[model samples]
Target: MKVGAIVTRIIRQMVRDKRSLALLLFAPLLILTLTWLVLDQESSDLKIATIDVPDSIITTLNDQQINVIDIDKPKSALKNSEIDAIIETAGNSLRITIDDSEPTNSQAIMMKIQQALVSKANVQQVEINHLYGLELSTTFDYVGPVLIGYFAFFFVFLVGGISFLREKSQGTMERLFATPIKSWEIVAGYIIGFGLFAIIQSFIVVLFAVYALGVPLEGSFWNVVLITLLLALAALTLGTLLSTFAKNEFQMMQFIPVVVVPQAFFSGLFNLENAPLWVEWIGNFMPMYYGAEALKEIMIKGNSIDAVVLEIAALIGFSLVFFVLNLGTLAGYRK
Candidate 1:
């Protein structure tokens, strides 16, 4: 009888927590729906630029669902990732130069091109060259930079949100409110306190990724660190802002499914080339997407800071917006 009462009480407690109930009931379904929306898209619509190629080859490529465009110079297109591969006639042989940053996509394009060339009896030899990534580069190498940024963002968000929630729950925030300290000052103090650790965390993760894991560092090490730090700051500010809506640590965790998971899907980890235009647009709002793009440009393409200044600006913008929101949320608590 006592055990039955205990079980009933626990069930009543769970039922009272509407957010927890909703998360349990709907989070998995939401994630699955997002996965379907992402993975259920059609195969990659690879674009290949051709120069002096026969009409038969172009026809074959089109039949394989690859877009074939004629270009006078393939170098610029390949460099910009505007086209996946460049095909041109070299005497009796064929020359194919591919952007190998995405090894999986590169391999798939090569396979399709080879299948198309198989039908051409006059084609003698096929010479393949890579524009960026090494010939031996694996899928991990392509995704490694993105993973580093994601981890840095994830940990900082989790820690910062929970820490700020602790300050509120422990009455520390109320004590601060009783003082002459401004809301913005309190927010800035918390940011500076947490941001120091975030910087250390970013450096450790980036260094480990490049040196221990052997992830290629094509650009300056400091550039990667700068991007990681900015991403962490964005995460930190966002976390503290969201914590204002949570009453406790468990409530803080509820934001993960609603906030963090969606960003992961849209953060360039998966190939969304064939997804709907709106699906791609969702990524533009995600800070991690810009961070991933910048990291890939520097780490894979060896591009300098000037090339990724726009992405850096986007990260800074996200941080500033979140910082302002934090200040606004704190206003309600001010005495």
Candidate 2:
């Protein structure tokens, strides 16, 4: 066929297949817009509640566009979330309460408050308490396990999805279908193979974060293993389910920007303190959020088994849902 005729034929085919065309062009845009709305929600200028403050400090804050809420009950202001941080200035000492959930914003607010205090006089070291940590902590200390969980989950998802797609394209899946074996049996076989590898991957990641990266490991090692294994199962189930939607390796890759990146943002790797409520709610739907939360609890907070059972339960529950969907998606192959 001539080049122009071939091109015309291709356009006709694409026009006829509206679903593929939309997946190629519009899905990314839709996801991008949602992510933008999630991340760009405007934060009110730092809300500061004070018991007593020098006129100089007050003027400096106003110049910085800080919303100063003069209040007697500093506790009530924080409890109500009316203020982002509190600065109680009594005598030469200043007591600061930083929410610490939004570490970046909280740090900025704390720094500005400190500078305001120093400008007033030779301030002795101020008493600072992070409502989250109660003491100074490293960012890696906070997010290291999360990063580990994410990297492990991301790689496993991609690998499993692409491998399953390969099986479909190579006719291997069809060959197996011709046999007496059941659809769920095929899924179970893949799981048994991938599950062992996933366990190894989780172990290496956890060990690297703890020993090499110096990430804290305060909880029971067994709890960490249990959570990681469950998280790996979730990734494996999601990968297999998504493979049914992807016709090829390239299409399998297309799932990442839509399915994977959002999890990272809402997975507690980045603080979602100021994120839109809808976006934050979306996190509750993603398996990574629970996995990372469980990891953080075990690694950083040193939470006990009782503390993380719900997170573990939720992760397992999500995996089971995906597993059922994975089986249902294979039903078309059944005789």
Candidate 3:
């Protein structure tokens, strides 16, 4: 009878939390639906540019379901990522230059090209070159930058949101409201206080990823750190803003499925190139997408900060917007 009474009380408590109940029932289904949308879509066509290649080779490539486009500047197209590869005749041999920024796409292009050549009689010698990756680069090398950005974002978001929520739940926010502090000042103080630790965390994560894990640092180390710090700030501001809506830590955690999980899917970790237009559109709104893209540009492609200015700008923009929203949310507590 005692155990039954305790169980009944716990059940009543759970039923009273409508948000938690809804999250428990619907979060998994939402994630599964997103997974299906990403994984079930047809892959985008593989486009290869051919310059002065034989008609037989082009026809073979087409037969193998690769799109072959005739172009005069195969090098430019490959560099611009306009095409996956460039195939051209170099004397008696055919030279294939692949954009190795994305190893999966490069591997796919290589497989299709080899299959096409093998099916044709008297296959010419093929010379392969990578645009960015080394011959020894692994899948980790391709994904490490994205992982760095993701971890930085994830930890900062989780810590900042929970910390801010704790302050509210503990009545610290109520005490502050009794002071002369403006709502924006409170938001600014929280960002600066949390941001110091976020900066430290970003540096630690980048250093470990590059040195301990042997992730290649093709670009300047500071560039990687800069992107990670910006991403962290974005996460910090976003977390504090969202925390205003959450009544407690449990509700803060509920934001994970709704906020963080979708960013993981939309971030460069998964290839959304072949997904529906709407799916890619959803990625546009995600700050992590820009963060991951900038990290890749610096780490993988060895590009300068100038090359990723747009992505950096996007991250700053997200931070500013979230900071403003945090200020607005704090206004409710002022009353």
lDDT of each: 0.78, 0.73, 0.78
TM-score of each: 0.65, 0.64, 0.65
Q: After superposition, how far is residue 106 of candidate 1 from its true place, in Å?
A: 11
What candidate 1 gets wrong by more than 4 Å, as runs, is: 1-123
TM-score of 1: 0.65
Task: Report residue 94 deviation for candidate 2 (angstroms).
Answer: 9.7
Clashes of each: 0, 0, 0
Candidate 3 colliding pairs: none
lDDT by residue (1-335, candidate 2, tens digit) is 23333235434554676764444334433443343345433344778887676666778777766778777677876877767888768666767887777756686686677656555555665654554452224455666667667766777687667767887888877876787767777777666656665776677666655665556788877778778778878888999899988888999999999998889988897778998899899889999999999998887788898988889889989999998999998996564
Which tens-of-lDDT digit does each residue in 1-335 have in candidate 3?
Answer: 33343335434543675654333333333433344344332224878998788898898899988999766687887888888898888998888999999766887777778878977768854455568745323456666788788777877788778777877999988986887667776677667766766667677777767776666688999999999999989998999999999999999999999999889898887888899999899888999999999998888889999999999999999999999888887886678
- What is the model-wide C-alpha lDDT for candidate 1? 0.78
lDDT of 3 at 27: 38
